[model samples]
Target: MGVIKGIEHVGITVPSIEAAERFFQQAFGAKTLYALIEKGGKSQEGDEMYDKNGLEPGTRIIAMRMMRIADGANVELFEVEGGHGATADAPSHMGIHHFALYVDDLEEAAARFRDAGGTMREGPIELGGKEKGPGNRCWFGVAPWGMQVEFIHLPSPIALDDQASSGPRWLPG
Candidate 1:
C-alpha cells in the first residue's frame, strides 16, 4: 500500500463562490488565495473529463476560490454551472458528514457564523465526560448551499495510547 502524507485541501461545491468567500472571511477569518473560472470543451463529454466525473457535457466551473483557513487547511469553493448531484441531507447522509473548524471560542464563532448567513443546525453543547476532553464544545451550522460545517473548541490535549506509533498533529498548539 502507498503511504499517505496528509490532506492538501478540501473541495466544497457552493452555489456562489463570492458568497462562500464572504462567509468564510466574516466567520472564520479565511483568506482567499485565488479565484478562477474553467470553461468546458469537447473533451468534457463522451468518456472525457466531465463525463467521467458525472458532470454535464458543457458544464462550466463558473467560479472557484481557494481560501486558507486559520489552521492552514485550504478550502476550494467551486461554483459549477452545470454540475450533477444534489446536496447531501447532512448528519444522516452516507458521504461526508461534516467538515469541522476548530476555534478558540465556540460560542463566539457560532454567533459570528450565524451573523455571516450560516444557519445553526445543532448545539453549542459540551461533550459529556472525557470522551472528547473537558469543556470541549461543538456546534453544527449549515452553509448557504446546504453544506454542514462544525465549529469545535477543544482546549485540552487529547490523550493517546502509549503504544500508538503516531498521533494527530493538526491541532493548534
Candidate 2:
C-alpha cells in the first residue's frame, strides 16, 4: 500500500461562512484562499443523493470559504442553507471532536479568541513530564456557532516512545 501524506484540510460546517471567516481571521490570522457556492434542487435523483449524504432534500450550500491558518493546515468553512444535522455540544460525542491550532503565545492566542467573541470552554492547562514534557500547554474555546477550537503551545514536538499507542503522534498531548 502507498503511504499516506499529511492532512490537507479539515471541513467545518458553520452557520455563516462570513462569520466563520471573520472569526478565523481575527483569532488566528487566517487568510481566505477561495470561496464557492453550491446550488441544490428538489428533483427525485437529487433528493436521493442528498438523503444518502445525510442532507435535507433541496439543501443548498450557501457559501464555502477555504482559509489558511498561519503556517499550519487549511480549514474549509461551509455554510449550508438546509442540512439535517445538529452540532455536538461536547468533545465526548462520536465525531470530529475538535481541531487544534498551534501558537507561540498561548495567552495572546486565548485573548484573541476571546476578543473575537469565542468563549473559553476549558483549560489553560499544562502538560509536562510523561504527558508531553514541560513546554506544552493548551486551552479550548468555542466559537459563536458552537464549534470547538483548541489552542496549543509546544516549543518542541513530542517524541513517542516504543510503549506509545498507535494514533496521531501529533495529538493527545
Candidate 3:
C-alpha cells in the first residue's frame, strides 16, 4: 500500500543495551539516533509507555536505544532485567530468523564483524540455481548478542524476483 514505505526498524531484546550498542558500533558502524529509555516506574511515563506499547506485565527495561546502520533499516535495542538472551541461539528456532545486510564487500564486512566478536559458519561461496543466479554470494554468522546475521552481495536481481516481491527489491549500488 502507498501508506507503507518500508521497514522502519527492527526491535530486539538484549541482555544489555550498552553492550549491544558497542557491538553494533564496532561491527557495523551503527550511530545512536536517540537517548536511552529506562522503564520500571522510574517515572509514571514508563508505566504509561509499557501499557501503550504492549509490553509484558512487570517488564523491567534497563535501557532501550535507537540506532542507524548505514542507510538501511534502523535498529532498536532493548535491555531488560533478567533477560536470558545474552548468547546466540543455537539449533535455530521459529519466528523471525536472521537479518541479512547487503554489503558491497562481504569479506570486508565479515572482517569487521569478526573483529567485533562475531562468528561465522562458512560460506561466502557463489550461490547457484535459478533464483540465486550467479555472482551472488552469502556469508552467515552470529552477532555478538547471539542473533543470526548474514552478509549478502547480490549483483543483480534473482530469478523470479519480480514475481515474488510486492515492490522492487532494494539493493546497494
Give each model a TM-score: 0.76, 0.74, 0.79
Query: lDDT per prediction?
Result: 0.67, 0.69, 0.71
Residues 1-173 of candidate 2: C-alpha lDDT, one tens digit per residue: 24975678987877766788898899888999987553243322224544454444555555667899866678887676544255343111222558988787888888999999998966788877655767788889988888788888876566556534544355322
- Candidate 3 per-residue lDDT, tens place, 67-149, comes to 99998999887765533332333101111367888899898998899999889778786777753756789999887667788
Each model's backbone clash number: 0, 0, 1
Candidate 3 lDDT score at position 58: 42
Q: What is the C-alpha RMSD of each candidate to the true structure, in Å?
A: 4.7, 5.2, 4.9
lDDT of 1 by residue, 78-159 (tens): 6655543543431111224479888888878888988998889768877655437777878899877677888878776666
Between candidates 2 and 3, the lDDT winner: 3
Off by over 4 Å in 1: 1-3, 38-47, 51-58, 86-96, 128-130, 159-163
Report the number of the highest-TM-score candidate: 3
- Candidate 2's displacement at residue 38, Å, is 7.3
**Runs in model 3 lying further than 4 Å from the true structure:** 38-51, 82-96, 128-130, 161-165
Q: Judged by lDDT, which candidate is best?
A: 3
Error of 1 at 145 (Å): 1.8
